[model samples]
Target: MTMKKEYRVKKNTDFQAAFKKGKSFANRQFVVYSLKKPEQKHFRIGLSVSKKLGNAVMRNQIKRYIRQAFLEMENEIQNEYDYIIIARKPVTEMGLQEIKKSLTHVLKLSKVLKA
Candidate 1:
């Protein structure tokens, strides 16, 4: 049997602890939040494609595309941060390059690129 990897931002009590815990940023297409983990040696990410984007098909398509975009960026991100990508409504009209570009831009904003 095989198990899938788990990559979700956990619950924390302090919002300040959370914000100081990580940096976040948003653009027209998406919002990204990231935190540095003391124990993790590799980076893991979660994607949030909200209902506001569209129906199931549109949401899933964006999720898949973003996941792929993240995969392409795995080498560039810091291993200590657990990344979360939240999709905005505008993302539905964008292509993979736009998605990838957004992901890269947000990472830079979140300091994940520096991480």
Candidate 2:
């Protein structure tokens, strides 16, 4: 499925706001930061894969996997938050299922998953 622009957290200010004001949860492979934005009409997601994880190729691979994972849960997500998913080093070796599992686990911990 395609990720529409409305579903993306696109600004530096948005990233910084999530980091500064959002609640965070972590698992083995991912750190999730979420800020509740009640006025927003949709969930906006930002993916962050640091250089510490790898070189350009590896980082892109991890990002692609994360985007795919988020897409899987897109329809089931609530529309009141902005979420930032940060990939840790171990995530570099994880496949799609692992990524999806980690994302779901974190979102559940943060109570972002829709009923």
Candidate 3:
């Protein structure tokens, strides 16, 4: 299943705001930037997978994995934040489970995911 539209950070301005104002955390595979938005009732996420990682197909696959991971972890993540996740080069070599693990690690580091 795909992530719901409301949970996605689609606008460039939203992404820029997160990057400039959020606190960030990183692991080997991903970087997560989180900005608290108390006015928001649910968390929103933005993803970035650089073209340098691979072809369009590969990047799309990585994004799919990330969205699935978040879907699974929805209850564990805080709802009042905007998160921007950037895939690092190493993510090009990972499968869904590995991607989930890496994403979890970064989210935990950012304190957006409950331990």
For residues 2-77, write the lDDT of model 2, one tens digit per residue. Answer: 7789988889999999999999999988899999999999888898888998899999988888888888888878
What is candidate 2's TM-score against the reference?
Answer: 0.93
Model 1 ranges with Cα > 4 A deviation? 1-4, 7-21
Local accuracy by lDDT, each model: 0.76, 0.89, 0.92
lDDT of 3 by residue, 45-83 (tens): 999999999999999999999999999899999999999
Clashing pairs in 3: none
Could you say which candidate leads in TM-score? 3
Q: Which ten residues in a row have the lowest lDDT in candidate 2?
A: 69-78
TM-score versus the correct structure, for each prediction: 0.81, 0.93, 0.96
Tell me the lDDT of model 2 at 43.
87
Write down the RMSD of all candidates, one decimal each.
3.7, 1.2, 0.8
Over 2-103, each residue of candidate 1 has an lDDT whose tens digit, in order, gives 112654443443224445666789888888777777798787676778898899999999988887887777788888877777899889999999999988
- The list of candidate 3 runs beyond 4 A from truth reads none
Ranking by lDDT: 3, 2, 1
Off by over 4 Å in 2: none
